[model samples]
Target: MEAAVKRRVEDYSLMDHATQSDPFEFYAALHEQCPVYRMPETGFYMVTRYDDLRQVLKDTDTFSNDVSAKDGKGLQGDLGVLYEEIIAERGWAHVQTLQRTDPPEHSRYRKLLDRVFTARRVREMLPYVDQVANDLIESWIDDGRCEFNSQFAMPMPGIIIAEQLGLGRKDVARFKRWADALIALSIRKWSEPEIRQIAETELEMQHYLFDVFEDRRKNPTGDLISALVHAHGDDEEPLSMHELQNLMHQLISGGFETTQSAIAHGLWLLLRHPETMQRLRGDMSLIKPFCEEAMRIESPVQGLARKTTRDVELNGTLIPAGSLVLTRYGAANRDPEKFECPHLFDIDRKNAGAQIAFGAGAHFCVGASLARQEMVSSFTALLTRLDDIRLEHDLPQPVHNPSLYFMPMKELPITFKKR
Candidate 1:
């Protein structure tokens, strides 16, 4: 309603450029001048400043997770994206990895999925994860010339998570399709037909998963799906079919994309700085920190869109109720005020351990532990076996998807020497 807010909206709503070029630059501009900007497209406000973002995320009472916000639905700040749209087409079980739910609902879904990522679960899986990574590495070890991204980084986590979920070898092909569909960034802006295509893919995937869930219900295999079938609230309400569907969708999206992107980006980062790689290979102890450091820099998830419950003030910026607010995690991660030499990747940074790649607040990613485990196993297997792992091609530029989430590399071609 204010001229300043209207003017600010015009700049931020140029989704044309934001979806194409480097959005971090745009976010930096927002952080510098208007850290909180209202968007006309979705009628939401976004905040990117370090202090503002931290405050907003932590203020769960004011900023609810169910950005499918109703009363203030048309307000100036809205946040939820990639929810039912992602689930209906892909099936609820697609990713069930967790995002965008308010406390009671999010807590219920998380309880079922969260157990898969426990310390004990992850530690136990490390050997198997390592074996998965090593087996892939060993196959390439003799080949001597391999495109690490496609050959190694992209596929290992898919196989490992699918197996750990007890989906087994039979489900490998469908699992990869789910992973590929989630990560294969559209080179062009997704048009109506493209949206239809995504819808269709979601439907087909949903049907496949529905079948799987049905089979699990009848047979009761005691796997995650079986556990889900049996999981309940204290009130003893069985998980609704819709909730189960959403749960499955989150699992597929999270399990597939995040790990693959982290591994790809981590390897790309290590490859870009051979000196860092050399130093890391020499001192493998540093690899864990290096992985976290790389994630801090090249964050797997880009930004989160949140809708404000009502008119609110953040960092002196007024966000009218019911607007889309993008919490630019990628930009926040690189904020120099938050991290020293934020642009430059440094594994040894003291605060590198504090990045929000898993996000902050009540809705933080449940799969953070799993992703960390996958990356640890993924890198350890590769770094330990490979003699000199380095890039084979020019550093690939980031392929930004039009969607508000995901910072996945289109392809990362690398050539490495084996021991």
Candidate 2:
């Protein structure tokens, strides 16, 4: 009789696409035996089941978002030696932004920013969004083909979010660059030069934001920055420069990276599933749900790290206190227990909204409404302005950064007939 080979958790590569084509399949196998599997490479526990993820996200006391604990070492601890200098020199230990902080402090910063993404504010962005999407399509509608990532997908959210944040349209490229660097840091391995590049970019982004905030202070505009600069929560003082910087970074990256990836991925999904594309083309109103379904299938932001405040037991496994736990939003969104035929990209999915693409609980993405708006508006323009839109390449390849945190299509070449 042949001996069975034990499936050691370390044997799987979380970041390498070469090892696995479908991450959901890889995770599904892992979830079958060990849903809360601890990674040997980084020692971060990954929770793949939908119920467990919801439990961890909701139980703020046991699972802490503010792993930094008043010291920005959370990133350093989760990322190891790569972030040693970043933690010390950059004062990373002190950062407890809305997404990273828990409770009382989190609510304070969240409330101040919440006003900016209110439904009315998002509604106001519709016309500008229509203009941006149409302008991009107009530039390439005649060419019959375009690299959708850089030309259309990347810039739609980039321009809209920049304008909303009181930044110049010319700075959209810069915003995308900074956001890319931030996501790159989540990777386990990088060359010295890459690390230096990230550190330098962080400093530049900080200085650039400093000047912008100074201008906003002196001459306020009806933008998110102005609202952040002037507003004070109930019995709370206005945000300090450091707090504002961290918050601003979160807003820009969250709004830019997540939405851009969704737009690109959504287009690719529609191209791959021509039936869904034809259905959407006919109805037109399905664009909204199509965006949600795309997000559910290929979540832009995959997973995030949280530190345990105390010893916790999940699914027969006991995790020690202070250990880092990674909740797999990508895996959870596709768990069979949560969604029927989870692997299929069903645009008419009745419960597509249940997906945690925007996360859940207190740290849920504040820009969810804005992201949804961008995706719906951009796709609507494409469907209206383009005819017989299809992928230029028979097997359109999706290039993802070798990081588990994000999955964005690197390039999408598609040919379309102008209407």
Candidate 3:
């Protein structure tokens, strides 16, 4: 595969556009040619193959997840100085928490997160998820039309995460504003002013979470926040205030945005593939794999950054130490070597569960169980409650999130009969 390489490692601009429009094609070419290519412009090594990406993620010792304070993933290197200034002005420490932390800190946080966010806990919340889905559907069912993304796909996860954290449903809008800012910061193209605005908004989010944590400490509502406030690490020392705030932000942003994007992208993919949709609507049992397929085909998170701790070799290519690396999950999921007929939307694909939409290794998404349950409950309610559901806009706009990190339909208007 490496013998036919024609694209240079510095051709990131071309790759960026290709990724935005059709990531599978771009990655397919890379996988067959330069599976482990470095980007000279951004100081990142782009790993597109499935096995190569997995190797980087699993070998945490060799690939440090320690992100720079100003730009953790280093994708936004252009704004590093500005970010440093912002951190200085705001008294912020850009420490890696949860997803970005390497062990033993990653192990410590994972254990604590798992305690509160277990599969059992997620299962217990199924009824609540169903109720939320049904309620959202009820609001628009009688109207005979709805913008699914805005009405259901967007707010459902936000509401669930807010309630889980003991925050009010009324606060979801604020949560979204904060979430949008964080996602924007991850995008490489945002201007310095835009990044500054996000930094300010994040400061606002931090302050808000601080208030909530204090309230949870005093009142002890038994929600996730309260548990986190009192929870002690393996060292038996309680989580510091900074750690508490960082974890809270991660939960809020990760829990709400990614799942919401997944649901939206799932619908977009299904609507475009009616046979798959009809099959899922009929069998119902296929919904799980159907969602899994959607995740693989249009992963909400395109990729995540990892920094090399030491020199590493993958697929016969050697990456030097201290280089930024990007794990292209969107590309890896579509590798034909990993999945048969990677382009097709096959709900019955046996290995659909192997998709790393929620990531893998020790840093796999903690809210995965919760997200899956929410999606299953949502699709169940959506398919059964809306009859003859179809897209309202012909040739609807392309699916793209505001940020480069995510890919989701900006607006998905649809019409259906009230069942």
Candidate 4:
């Protein structure tokens, strides 16, 4: 008998596309041997333990979100330089907003965002969300088979966000391309030509958004873009054009990408676990918990970068000042120390809500509630309208696209009977 090869922390490469596609094994190894691991290829530290990540997230002062300071260290080599040359020459330069700013500076943007993304707004939007879900389902229910990601998952949220941003549902295709371009650099390994193309697309989006912002400012429509344009406290100053542009970039990316991933993965999970699907069909009330567990298992925004403000020791690992730290939310969600049988897909798991899939503390995702509602809406519609959902036999294996930043499935081809 051959001896089983033991895995070491050093054996894993965070930059590899294959590893990014299925990283649970790496997460397990990091959690066991080194919760605070430094990548040999890039020297970036990754924090994997649940408690340690919470601590890092909470201590915003010690762990900053200001990634611009370390510009060249990002995965996109020379892309930042290209961005400056391309964008600054034609349009407004990108500035740090909600996801990239820290402390009092972050507070300014957060207050405005909180006002725009209010709970009442999300509540009011629920009906429309359900309508979109059903409408998309109606498009493919007759076929008894559909490409879940493109046909349903991608467009459902895409149309909603486009309409909310005052662009109307007709522009969803362009909106998706713009959003994809905005996030392309951080998600995967790209060639030099591809990087330039991404930059060009970004410039195109900047110009398009500039025109929209001007229109919203001149005529204050009550859409999300209008709210952002007019939002400010009596004491605070109005946001500059640079600020608004960056905010739009953040909103456009955050509004749909993660939610799309969540919706697709939710159905994929149920298809994989027929018993869970039957249980959810019986009790529909468990849909919320099912969404929570789905996000916990396959977090959409897998890991985000945070720059250390000063030298700090975390779980006995000493990290230097101004170093990049990747808080692996995907890894933390599955830490054996945090959850019993971490790999099991238990919809009834009591503490499933404790997962930091939306992150934690000051920088928690602002669209979290909306994302949850969308997931609930999508799954509820699927269960109500379809039966015996199962993966198509000819479908490709390893469905998920390889991405370091986002957990996007390349495609999900499923068949089901209309109920």
Candidate 5:
């Protein structure tokens, strides 16, 4: 094996774009030296070890997901306050629903979400997912070359989630804009003006969704939005318009972006390991394992913030009460203690499905099933339809956009022969 890059715990910074772009080395360093390292810039603690993260994730009481209570000192910092203010001015105030809430309250929302995003629903949508993947591949297969992210990755999940939300396939571009605006606030650094501009775009989305919510309430259309609007059938209290808005915020952003990252990274992994690609091309049975390993090696949702409810020590390091702790899923997924040759992309690895890329415990991603199906559907179509898949060498080295939370590829230029 090549000598590991010499790095100190101090050398890493989540605020740095370059660090965010390629953090695996830093994650490896964290695994070896500082399993729970405090960020000097933001004063937040990063828990990198797999067991440590599982502890944090499972013990929601100790590490609260109700980050709104922290007064906007979580991942986005004071920018979260600015965002809330902007939305409150023009639209419903942000509420803690699925991703933001804790315990009993969260269970209420989760139950409703589970009803709509059920296994039956995802299985039923498989044909549509397959069709979307095929349609996207067909669009560029004849051209022999395409920018994978813009042309295929972004749209496959986007159109599915859009039509499911009753936004219709035609409004996928608008849905993308809305999702991007919401995601930008969390993942990127921005100036005051830029923050305001992004917040305004979020408000635009809120207003549009609000109109949809009102329509769904009056006349149910059987779409996901309609189901969410009328999910409670008189026995339980229905989700308020405010709660619905926040839930929609989570769904839209969660639905498309992470899956896009996963699909793009899956292809990138195949391109990097031609032998693995060849093995996969020979046996489509390996596609699911390929997806699992892709998610493990290149986690899309790298980390999410949790506020400590009380002072606690993790791996000999003490974290104070009210301190923001980032559960580094990307780091934990590569922990050498958990997986041998942790950095190696091994599709046959038995524990690949155990990766917490979709998170673990109660706050585990609600759309995980859909995301998995989307990835499997995507790669199954891509490998079946295209031959000689290779990257366009002239493009930039780091294809991923800089993001603190997500590992989204900005573009993926590649050439392939239609098989």
Candidate 6:
């Protein structure tokens, strides 16, 4: 690096805090000074600029996801990295089941669930999706005031996921809790005892899904889980018990929060920005762009973690091997150089397709189409049925994770004007 370039690098350790709510300021600073930043505390490389994030995420070879951080560094002491060797081996089963795999294995596992989420299948699922949304609207319409998060946002999408996987709605509360913990655990540190409790609960979740997969093998059903057991009509290797359970875990986990947050957040966006909300309520066609803008403004998943394999130059910064490389999907979506008035929530803006919310490349979110459909169905149903939907109170400040993986709301109360 040139002397001037070396001088531009700054320490971002001071920005790390337990009580921190908004870390975007750090991201903005990093974007301006250095697209590739090294946090002083954790030593992990942070990529904020749109091009840089795309570069790293698209090249998975140099940037691996096995997550053995380089030189024994990167997010050290995080409870997520505290597992023993034995636990680490067990966790490999968990990891191999989803995000950690590469190429052929990744392709094989991803294909099993792909058919259900493709555009054709998503359209087939739409009537059922609309029914689910309308059912929630019916339940909440009489109340006039509702805790929208629990009453509507949480239930409808989760039930769709449960049925898709051959699970029942009875597991909603437990499944929701487990999903939240798994996402939050990236940033939230827990006591030893609490970690043990969560581990045991995860085991229970695994076992429950395993039982469903096993039973389906004996009595074949058409559900995704059963099909996976029978290789889903694919000539690829039939999923082992571990692979079957893990694949189910990923599908269920992906559906649990991304759809919930998207529904809750699309509503939050419509409620917070009066002009956008008014425009959307008036024009039915803008629903597509509105969903696009909401995702850009408030992405369901914040960032992705990758473990680097070899030294590679990214926008003049050398990312050493085995380091955790974070592609800031949330931050990149707001890169002003790429999107005009990036911070403003305007659905009419051009280049709406430029947002990185669903991610880029082969690792892109598997359920992007399903998520978009759910948002469209839910928003259309809400606007058609509920006379008016607006915020009943101020949105509690949005939550941020040091892990930068989720944008979850604490609470959102809503009032609906009777049609």
Best by the TM-score measure: 5
Model 2 per-residue lDDT tens digits across residues 373-408: 888899888888888888787543336545667776
lDDT scores of the candidates, listed in order: 0.67, 0.79, 0.79, 0.87, 0.88, 0.71
Residue-wise C-alpha lDDT for candidate 4, range 1-419, written one tens digit per residue: 21122598779787777678778888888888899999887788999999999999989899999886226777765666666566777888878888899988998899899998889999999999999999999998999999999898889889988888898777888888998988877787677688778878888888888899999999988998899988986887889888998998888888778889998888888878899999999999999999999999988988999989999999999999989899999999998888777888999899999999999999989989888998999999999999888888644545567677887888888888999
Higher-ranked by lDDT: 4 or 5: 5
Error of 2 at 364 (Å): 1.2
Tell me the lDDT of model 3 at 310.
83
- lDDT: which is higher, 1 or 4? 4
Q: How many backbone clashes does candidate 2 have?
A: 3
lDDT tens digits, residue span 1-419, model 1: 11122223245443564533356556656656666776666555667667677877887667766554223242211211232344444554333224666666667667766654577877776777777888787776887778766677667877766765557755656876765554332222344445455555666766776777788778877677777776665787776666666676667767777788789888877777888888877888898899889888888776766667788888787877655677777778877678766778788889998887887887788778878888888877777877676566665444444445666566676666666
Which candidate has the top score in lDDT?
5
TM-score of each: 0.84, 0.92, 0.93, 0.96, 0.97, 0.89
Candidate 3 lDDT at 184 equals 68
lDDT of 5 at 333: 91
Model 3, residue 9: distance off in Å is 9.1
Alpha-carbon shift of residue 125 in model 6 (angstroms): 0.5
User: After superposing candidate 6, which stretches have Cα over 4 Å from the reference?
Assistant: 1-20, 68-92, 232-235, 398-403
RMSD per candidate (Å) reads 5.6, 3.8, 3.0, 2.4, 1.4, 4.3
Model 6: how far is 396 from its true place, Å?
3.3
lDDT leaderboard ranking: 5, 4, 3, 2, 6, 1
Off by over 4 Å in 5: 1-5
Q: Of 1 and 6, which scores higher on TM-score?
A: 6
